[model samples]
Target: MNHKAWSIHFIYAGVILLLAGGQMYAVESYQLTPSATKFLAHNVGPGPETAQGAINHFMVNSNTGVRETITPPGWVAWAALSAGAVLSVHGGMLIANKR
Candidate 1:
């Protein structure tokens, strides 16, 4: 492949790796309290129940045993998606410029 194509490919790969890392971090760092789970179960749809359960389970594992704060996976996912999109655009520009 040409240098431009290679550069674009590298950019895309980097973005994918970043997104994957963020997803892994979010999955490992996820935490939710019992009260938060209860609230989500009552307020949010069933779809979020599993995530809430995971958080609740994590909370139970901690010594504090108190609901502190939680970072939703959606945020991480969105950020990754955004970064990927930006990378794709940058790659596209590089390819276009080479023509």
Candidate 2:
């Protein structure tokens, strides 16, 4: 309800964003296990991305594993990094002002 409380929430959100951004940036790609991929395909039918002119994300099934082509935009990482930095800095400033 108070400024400090909001600041703490900001800090928490910023930290989570930072962690998520770091993870997204660090891992270029990942694959689901064969069994997991099979399960997913079985439950969720249709792969539009497999066809031409598909605007949505989709996964590829292969012997190795299933890989989803989400977060294809390169700017996502930079956006997350910038947002996290700004949020974290703003939160720290608010906390400092309280003292």
Predicted model with the maximum lDDT: 2
Worst 10-residue lDDT window, candidate 1: 40-49
lDDT of 2 by residue, 1-48 (tens): 999999998888888888878887887765656666566565565555
Clashes of each: 1, 0
C-alpha local distance difference test of each model: 0.64, 0.69
Q: Which ranges of candidate 2 are over 4 A from the true structure?
A: 33-71
User: Which sections of candidate 1 miss by over 4 Å?
Assistant: 1-6, 14-72
**TM-score between candidate 2 and the true structure:** 0.62
Give, for candidate 2, the lowest lDDT window spanning 10 residues. 52-61
lDDT string for model 1 (31-80, tens) is 67766755654555534358866665555455454654555555666666
**Cα lDDT, model 2, residue 36:** 61
